[model samples]
Every structure is written in structure tokens, then in C-alpha cells.
Target: MISIELIRKNPNIVRASLLKRGENLTILEDIIKKDEEYRSVLKKLENLRHERNVASKAVAELKAKGEKFSKEVKKVNKINDEIKKLEGVTKSIKEEINEKLLWIPNIVHEDVPEEEDKVIKEWGEIPKFKFEPKGHYEILSKLGADFERASKVSGARFSYISDKLVILEMALARFAIDFMVKKGFKVFMTPHMVRSKAMYGTGHFPRGIEEAYKIEKEDLVLIGTSEVSLASYHSGEILQNLPLRYSGFTPCYRTEAGAHGRDTKGMFRTHQFHKIEQFIFCREEESWKEHELLRENVEEFYKVLGLPYRVVIVNSKDMGNAASKQYDLEVWFPSQNVYREVVSCSNTLDYQARRLNIKYMEKGKKKYVHTLNSTLVAIERTITAIAENYQTEDGHIKVPPTLVPYTGFGEI
Candidate 1:
């Protein structure tokens, strides 16, 4: 959530953010109007309370004198009634304001493009093939990807990996966890389900709710990424650590509600996948540096795997709701002759901390901590990358040299 104080002081800044995101400007206007009304009602309530206090005092004094105080008592009672009504009104208005604020996206960084993705950096060499390359689904199925059984059990966008494919997926996750741990991150296997509060805290609710898998008659929902769990871990706490870093591995669930036909053939887009996420909580002034560090960590992981990839700055309209700035690591897929998104790094810049009520005492004052998240690896997609890139002429897959120690096999 954005700071209401920022809107109160300069609404145009918030208005510009809305414009950049192509959001309804009227939401901002409504929040401003509701905020003004809340303040007005609050002032009136204070006055009524003051009047009731004075009237009660007068009634008390009259009673002490053995005099009738019915009129004064009634006056105080009426003032009390007025205060009660105004208090309810104030509360309702505040709730409305908050509801609107929750819908607002974070302010975009000035350097971010308005719409089109801006390619900032490229790494590794795009692989050249001696023959026409096969798609990951074609290569991986031979290694035991049982899509037909998966569809019979769970429908489309699902896969059952057996044989070497299962080992490859596990190796991908293990490789990511070990890499992140050595980079000074505390690793966790986070819970697969989280409460609505956790979802909202991570800026994944009230808008992206359609993409989540919620438990029936319960507040819990299957998490889409470990970032949701990691971000909410420090909720409602005051931290002394300035740059707390964490890496979490979890099975993520998603509905993929908006994606109907895209990447429907294989593991590239799926209903469930395993991921290792990188998260950091730091002072506001340190988030940009932390953001770069997060990006470098994921980039290095890909480099070690010898995968060709490009980093793109996500545009304002295309970035996640919580991110002030975002970068996507798109790995090469020789079969499609395109780079696909496998990792994302973002700097939320206190957007999530404010919503989660997470704070840190700095210079004797409490302030929201900026939060950042990055995907170290998405097991299914990374598997797809490796299968296609390292395919042998004999229709086998070679494990990336970096993950060979984990898989204990050079080829599949």
C-alpha cells in the first residue's frame, strides 16, 4: 500500500502513477475525497466529545449542589450519541479509503519505460544448432514426462515426471538452494499455503486473487511463489537488522486464469511448479543496491549453467503491482528461437512493508523496510531450458555441468 501521507501532500504524484499504469483515475479521486471526509468527520467527533465532557462536568457540578441536572445530562447524552455516529462514519470512510489504496499500483521508477520492454543486458551466447532443434516437450518426454497421465489426473498444464526427468527437476531446485545459501542467504522450505493477510501483504490479493487457489471455506490459499511466505515472515515486527536476506524453496500453485492458450503444450506454463525465491528486507535507501544484488545472484546462477539469457527492464504497465522496478531474466529456447521468462527480480521500495505493517527503527524513528524478491530457479522452466539447449544428436539430454554433481549423472 502507498503512504496516505504521500497522497495527502501531493496527489499528483499518485495520479501520475495511476496514469502510467492505465488505472482508473477516479479511484485516486475517490480516495482523496474519502480521506477529506474522514478528517472532517474526525474533527467534528473531537468537538462533540469535548462538548460532552464539558456538559458532563456541568451536570456533575449541579448534582453536587443537590440541584436537578436532567437538562444537562440529556445534553451530554445527545453529544455522546453524535460522537458515536460520527465515529462509525469515520471508520467506514477510512476503510473505503484503504480499499481504494490497496488497488493502486506502486509508483514506477522514472527510468522505466512506459510500455515496451527495455533490454538492458545480455549474457552468454545463444546456442547454434547443427540440425533443427526440438522443443523441450519433445526432448523431455523421451526422458519420462507423462503428460497423458497428468492430464487424466489433473487436466491440462500438468505433467508427471518419471525416470531421469524427476531427478533433473530435483537437481535444479537443489542447485538453486545451494547457490543461494552460499551467497549469504538463510534458506527455508516455506509453507505451501498462506492466509489472506499474507497474500495481501505480498501484493498478490484484491487484484491477482483470480490467479490463486483458495481453500474452500477457509482463509488459506496455495501460494504462487515463496516470496509470499518470505515477505510476510517479518509482518508486524520491528527489525534491528538492516539487510536481512532469505531464500525459500516451495511448491507453488497457480490457476493461470488469464492464460488460456499460451504455453499450453509443456512445462513452460503449468499449474504447479517448484521454485527457489530470493527475498531481502532492507532500509529504504538500500533497496536499489539490494535489487541489483538480487539480479546478479540469479544472473550468476544462469551463467554457471552456461545458459544464454537476456535481462529486460519491465515497463511500468507490465510490472507487478508491488514492484517499483522489475527485471526479467529471459533464457534462450533454441527450439522456439526465442527467450522466455524464467526469473524475475524486483524492488518494491516499501510498497509491501507498509501493507504488512513491517517496520524498522532507524535513527530512533520507525520506517517501512523496502522488500525485494527474485527467482533463483523455476524448476520446470529451467528443466525446459536445459533439455532443449543440451540435447544430444541421439535424442538424449545432458545435465548442465554445474548441476552434474547434484544429479550424479552426465546424461539422461
Candidate 2:
């Protein structure tokens, strides 16, 4: 949520940022008006209660003097009724303001470009294949993978890994967890199901609610990524630590609602898949540096895995709702002859901290911490890229040198 103080202080700045995101800032006017009305009603309630107290005293004094006090007593009762009505108005307006604020997205960073995302850096060579490249699914199916069986049991867009492919997924996950833990991140295998507040804190709710799977009876939703659980773990708390990093692993679930025709042929757009997410909470001033550090960390992981990738800075309108700035690592997909996003790193600044109320004390001053998250690895997509990029002409798979130790073989 944007701080109301910010709106009051720089309405023009807010308005321009929203316009860049293609949103109208008039909603802030609605909030400001309701806020004024609420404050006015509160003032009326205060004066009315004070008047009622004075009338009560007058009535008691009249009774003590053995004088008629019925009119004073009725006036006090009427004042009490008026206060109750004003209180209701105040409550309703307050709720309206809160709901409106929840819908407001974070302001974009001034440095973020308004145009399409620009490539910041290109790493490794884009492979040139001597033979015609088979798409990930085509080659994998012939190599004993079983998406057909998964569809038979769970319908389209679901996949069941069989034979060596299952081992590749485990190797990639284990390799990532090990690599991240060595860099000071606390490892957490988060709960797959989370409450709605968790979604809201991660800026995935109220608007993104449709993308998640809801368990209505339990009042829980299946998380799209462990980022939601990791971000919400410290909600409403003031932490003693200055910087807390988490490497979270989970089998994510999404309805993929309204995404009917995209990536339907493979595991890339699936109802369920595994992921390793990087989440950080750091002092506000150091957040931009931390954001870069997160990107560097992912780059190292991909480098060690011997994958060709590029870093693209997401533009203002493309950064989504929460990130003030975002960077994506798109790995080369040989079959598509283009790069596909395999990891995304975002600096949400204090947007999530404001929403979640996560803070740290600095020199006796309590302040909201900036939150950042990145995709360390998405299992199926990484496997797809690896399979497509590293296939030999003889129809064999060569595991990355770094993952060789974990997979117990150089080839799969």
C-alpha cells in the first residue's frame, strides 16, 4: 500500500507514476475525500460525546436539587444516539479508504524505462545447432519422459516425470539449495497452502487472487511460489536482525486462470511445479545494493550450470504491481530460437514491508525494511532449457559440470 503521507506530500509524483502504469490517480482523490469525511465525523462524535457528558452532569445536579431534569435526560439520550450514527459513518468510510489503498500499486522507480525491457547484459554464446533442434517436449518424450501419462491421470498441462528426468529435477533443486545456503540464506521448505493475508502481504492478493487455487473450506490458498510464505513469515514483527535472507523451496500451485492458450503443450505453464526462491529483508538504504547482489547470486548459479542467459531490465509498465524495479534472467531456448524467462529478480523497496508491517530497529529508530525476491530456479523450465541446450546428436543428455556431483553422473 502507498503511504497516505506520500499521497498528501506529492500528489503530482504519485499521479505521474500511476499514469506511466496506465492507472488513473483519481482514486487517491476518493481516498482523500473519504479521509476528510471520516475525520470530520470523528470530530463531531467527540463533540457530541462531550456534550452528552455535560448534559449528564446537569441532569444529576438537577436531581440533587430536587428540580425537574427530564428534558436534560432526554437531550443526553439523543446525543448518545447521534454519536452512534456518526460512529457508523466513520467506520464505513475508514473501510472504504483501506480497500482503495490496497488496490493502489507501488510507484515505479524513476530509473525504470517506459519502453519495452532492454537487455542489460548477454552472457555465454547463443548456441548454433548443426542439426534441427527438437523442442523440449519432443526430445524428452522420446527419451522416456511421461507427460502423456500425466495428462491421462490429471488432464492437460500436468506432467509426470519418469526415469532419468525425475532425477534431473532433484539434482537441480538440491544443487540450488546447497549453492544458496553457502551464501548465508536460511533454507525453508515453505507450506504449500497459505492464508489470504500471506497473499496480500506479498502483493499477490485482491487483484491476483484469481491466479491462486483457493481451498474455501480451509480458508487457505495454494501458493504460487514460496516467496509469499517467506515474505509473510515476519509479518507485523520488528526484527532484531538487520538482514535476513531466505532460500525457500516449494512445489507451487496456480490455477493459471485466464491463461488458456499459452504454453499449454509443455511443463512451462503447468498447474503444479517446483521452485527455489530467494527472499531478502534488509535496511532500506542498502536495498538497491541488495537487489544487485541477488541478481549476481543467480548469475553465478546459472554460470556454474553452464547455461547461456541474458539479463533484461523490466520496463515501468512491465514490472508488474509490486516491484519498483525488476530484472529478469531469460535463458536461451534452442528450439524456440529465443530466450525464455527462467528467473526474475525484483526490488520491491518498502512496498511489501509497508503492507506486511515488517520492520527493523536502527539506532533506536524502527523503520520498515525493503524486501527483494528472485527466482533461484524453476525446476521444469530449467530442465527444459538444459535438455534442449545440452542434447547430443546421439540422443544423450550431458548434465552441467556443477550438477554432476549431485546427479552422480555426467550424462542423463
Candidate 3:
């Protein structure tokens, strides 16, 4: 949640940010009104309590003087009743104000390009086809991939990536982990099930709640991205460095409820997918620099796979609630003849850290940590891109040279 103090101090800034996001300005106006009303109620409640205390002292004095104190006692009792009623009202109003404040998005960074991102650089070249090529589904099925069986066993939007594809998945994951480790990140396998607090801490809950898979029995949620668990791993802890990098490999679960009927044909969208996620905690002053480092990591990973890709800085309107600035690395999909998003890197600044209470001591002073996250590899989408880009005109799938050793074979 954004700091209400900041909003109170500069509502115009908040209003302008909401406009950029195309959000309802009335929401901000309502928050301001509720905040004012809550403050007024709090003041009244405080005054009532002070009056009660004064009346109680007067009653005590009357009793000490051995004078009839019945009238004073009744007056003190009336004051106490008013204080109790006001306290209840004040508490309810404060809760309502806080609940409303949680839905607001973070302010967009000033330097984030307002226009659509232009391709600054390109890598590799698009492979030309000599014969008509088939999509991944057709190619994988002929090689004995049993997605139908997977759906029957686990329901729709599930798959059993058998044969060489399973090996390919592992190769991709291992390749990503090694890449991140070389960049000084401590690799971890994070827990798949996280508490509600962890989900909200990463700014996934309260905004994207409907898209998450909830475990109603344990009141835990299956994480949509490893970033959630990785970011929350240091929750409430204070660090000393400006940049602390961590990588996590985990199976992410999502309802994908809102994406109904879209990308439903292939692995482009799924309820569960394996991901190697990269997360960083840094001081506010160093967040933008770390953001570029994270983007470079993704770009390098794709380049090593020998795929032609481009990086685009996402505009403010397209950035989600948690991110102040974002960029996407899109790989060329020859089948679609367009670039498809494969990885996104975001600089959340202190938006997530402040809510999670993730902080650090910087130069002998305390401050909220700035959090950033990027995708190292989402296995399914990466596989989709690879399948489309590296498909043979005959019937084979060519594995990238970088992943051949990990797979123990060069091609499938």
C-alpha cells in the first residue's frame, strides 16, 4: 500500500499518477475525503477521552473532600460512555480508510519513456523456412508428447511434456540457474505455498487476488511467481548492502482465470509452469542501476540460446500496480511473425518493500529497501519461443548449442 502521509501531503501528484494509469480519479478523491473524516473522528474521540479523564478526576476530588459525590460520579459516567462510543466509530472509520488506500498503484518513474518502446538493439537473425513449418503442438505430438492425457488427468491447461521435451525443460532450467549464479546471485529453491502475508507483501494480493490459486483449507496461496516468495524471503529483515541478488527456481501456480480462451492452444498460457525467477533488494538510490542489470541478465540468457530477440521498455500505462518502471524482452516467434513477451524486469522501488516492511540500514541510517524482480526463465514460454524459432522443416527440434551439454544431446 502507498503511504497515506505522502498522499495527504501531495494529492495532486497522486491524482496525476492515477491519470497516467487510466484509473478512476474518484477513488483518490474518496480516499482524501475518508482520510479527512477519519482524522476528524480521531480528534473528537481524543477530546472525549480527555473530557472523561477530567470528569473522573473531579469526582475523585469530591469523594476525597467527604462531600456528596453522587452528581460528579454520574457526570463522569456520562463522559465515559461518550468516549467508548466515539472510540468505536473512530476505529471503524480508520479501517475503511486503510482498506481503500490499499488499491492504489505506485507512481510511475519520470524517466520511463512515455511512448511505445523502440528496438535499441537486435540479436541473431530470423531463420528462413525452406518448407512449410508446423507449430509446437503439432511437432511435439508427432514426437509422442501426451498433452491430451495430461488434461484428462489434471484438467484443462495442463500438459505432460514427455520424450525429449522433458529433458529440454530441465536443460533450460539448469542453464538459467548457472547463468544467475555466475552473476553473484545466491540460488534458492523457494517454497511453493506461501502465507497470505507473503502474497500481499509482494504486491500480488489485494490487486491480482482473483488470479491466484488459494488453498482454502490452510489459508495459504500457491504463488503465481517465484518472485513473490523470493521477495518476501527477507521480509522484516534489515540489510546493509545497496544490492542483494537472489535467484529462485520453483513451480508457479496461477488460476489464469482472466485469460479465458486466449493462448489456450499452446504452452503460452497454463495453470502451472516451472520458472527460474530473479529478485533483488537494494537501496532506493541504486534501484535503477540494478534494474538494468536484471534486464541484461534476461537478454544474455536469450542471446546464449541463439534466439533473435529485442528489449522494449514498457510504457507507464502498461506497467502493473506493483511496478514503477518495467521493460520486456520479447523473442521473435517466426510462426506468429511478431515478437512475443518472454521476460519482464521491473523496478518496484520502495512500493513493495514499504508494504512488506523490508528495510535496510544505509550509511548508518534506516530506510525501506527498494525491491526489483525479473524473469530468468519461464520454462513453458521459453520452450514455445524455442520451438517456433528452432523448428526444422522436416520433423526435428534443434536444441540451442548452450543447452546441448545440459540435455546430453544436441537436437531432438
| lDDT scores in order | 0.91, 0.88, 0.85
The C-alpha TM-scores of every prediction are: 0.97, 0.93, 0.92
Can you tell me which runs of candidate 2 are displaced by over 4 Å?
A: 49-76
Order the candidate numbers by TM-score, best to worst. Answer: 1, 2, 3
Q: lDDT per residue, candidate 2, 1-412, as tens digits?
A: 7887887778788788888877876887888788878888899989998999899999999999999999998999899899889988989988898888888888898878887888999899877878988788887887767788888999888987777788888989999999888999999998999899889888998878889999968879999999899999999999876688998999999888868888887777889999999999999898999999999999999988889999999888778688898999999999899998999899998988998999999888989999999999999889889988998777778888888888888886
For model 1, the superposed segments whose C-alpha errors exceed 4 Å read 63-67
Cα lDDT tens digits for candidate 3, 2-62: 7888889999888878887778888788889988988898888888778878888888898
Per-residue CA lDDT of candidate 1, range 1-412, in tens? 9989999999999999889887879888988889999998999998898898899999989999999999998898889888889989998999889988899889988878997999999999888878889998888788899887899999999999998788888888888878987999999988999999999988998989999999999999999999999999989999886799999999999999989889888899999998999999999889999999999998999999999999999988889999899999999999989988999899999999999999999889999999999999998989899998999888898889988898899999
Worst 10 residues of 3 by lDDT: 111-120
Candidate 1 weakest ten by summed lDDT? 168-177
Q: Between the candidate structures 2 and 3, which one is better when assessed by TM-score?
A: 2
Query: lDDT at 370 for candidate 2?
Result: 92
Candidate 3: residue 347 lDDT (0-100): 90
RMSD of each candidate?
Answer: 1.2, 2.2, 2.3
Candidate numbers sorted by lDDT from highest down: 1, 2, 3
Q: Looking at model 1, how many pairs of residues clash? A: 0
| Steric clashes per prediction | 0, 0, 0
The best candidate by lDDT is 1
